[model samples]
Structure formats: C-alpha cells, structure tokens
Target: MRSSVDIETIFATMAVGLVAVASILMTSAPLGAQDGSRSRPVSLGADDRAAALESVQFALAELGDGASYVWHRGHGKLSGVVQPTQSFVDGKGRVCRHVVVLLSAGEKSRKTEAIACRLENGVWRFDS
Candidate 1:
C-alpha cells in the first residue's frame, strides 16, 4: 500500500540511474568508434621532445641508422625514426628544432621534415 508520492520517487530514482548508466557507457566507448574524426595532434613540450629524442637516439644506436620505431601518443600511433638535422630560432622568436622523421604506417610511408617550436606555455608544436 505505497502512496502516490512513493511511486513517483521510485520512478524518478530509476530514471536517474538509467541516465547515469547511459552516460558512463557513452563516455567509455573508444574515441575512434565515437565519430568519423581523425586523431588530433598531441602537444609535446621541449622536455617531452628531448625525452622522445633520447628514446629515438637509443633505438637508433641499437638498431643503427634509418631504423623504424613505433611511437604512440594519445590515440595516434606513428612508426618513424627521428633524425635531428639542426636548430634555429623561428620568426616568432621561438627556438625550433629541425628534424626529419621517416614515417611509415601500413602501406603508406613518407619522409617529413618538420620544425618543432616551443610555445610560451612550454609546449612544442609543429611549425611546418
């Protein structure tokens, strides 16, 4: 013999629980399956680049030059080898590192020369 108020309260609680479960399922889904969008760029600071360079260098030292290694950041996976060419200051007054990374993924492969510059927030971004 529950009152009408009790029935309303039970229905409201059930609705909230269902909504919470739906939200959790939605968020837990894989990023790639959610939409038809590509993986976004990941910000690597100077320190991060330096660390990555060290890892690359070590891999190169062990595997020899032109060796390919897999680099994973965020949702993106890049198989490449980083070869440091030089360093220079950009027009924006940021110190940039010039490097050639030979990237290969599946049947696609390309050699890209990129300049990574440090931003004001200490994050390194690709200038070109």
Candidate 2:
C-alpha cells in the first residue's frame, strides 16, 4: 500500500546506509590487505626483538650519516638493516642521531625511524 514516493525514499535511505557501511569497512581494513601490495610486518619473538634492538642501538651510536649495518646475520629469525641518516647535537650538547631501521620477518617487512640521543653517561637511548 506504500506510495511511489515512499518507495523511492526507502530505497534512497537503504542506499545511503549501504554507502556508510562500505565507507566504514574501507577505512577499517588494512592498507596491505586491501591493495595486496604490501604485507604488514610480523612481530618478532623476544630473542629476535632483543637482537634487533641491540643492532639498532649499535648503528645509532657508532655509524656515521648514511652508513648502514646489517643485522641478524646467521642466528635470529628477524633480519634487518640499520642506518644512521642524520646526526646533530641537541641544545643540551647531547649528540642525537636519526636512524632508519628496515626490519623483515619471512615475507613481511617494515621500515621505522627513530631518534636516539647520547646520554651524559655515554649510553645512547631512543627517545620516548
């Protein structure tokens, strides 16, 4: 018994609802999953994480700009390259370096950047 206008309005509302649902799904989905181009980096186990962090710290502390060190050579499940991209002295005279870490596990990989500052005690630590 619905009029023609009522039917049209119902269809319009349903269309809008569907569009909203689709928008939500599109935004919530991961970029790699949607595009099939990049896979998200898988998490490393505790030992692997520790090894990677140690290598990253060494690169940040010792490597000059544009120098890179490859890590996880023969033992760990995680492998990566750590490079110091830039270095500068902070206002407090602490040497700070910008480091890039390319980490990979199996077929997944991720690149991360961090700034580490040398402390007064001569230890380099990543900024929190």
The top-ranked prediction according to lDDT is 2
The residue-by-residue lDDT of candidate 2 on 2-65, one tens digit each, is: 1112222322343222112112112233223434666663333345545655776678777889
Residue 73: error of model 1 in Å?
10
Model 1 residue 59 lDDT?
42
| lDDT scores in order | 0.40, 0.55
**Candidate 1 minimal-lDDT segment of 10 residues:** 16-25
Instruction: State every prediction's TM-score relative to the real structure.
Output: 0.37, 0.61
Using TM-score, give the best candidate's number: 2
Number of clashing pairs per prediction, in order: 0, 0
With candidate 1 superimposed using the best TM-score fit, by how many Å does residue 1's alpha carbon deviate from the native? 61
- Model 2 error, position 38 (Å): 13
lDDT score of residue 71 within candidate 1: 61
How accurate locally is residue 112 in candidate 2, as Cα lDDT from 0 to 100? 52
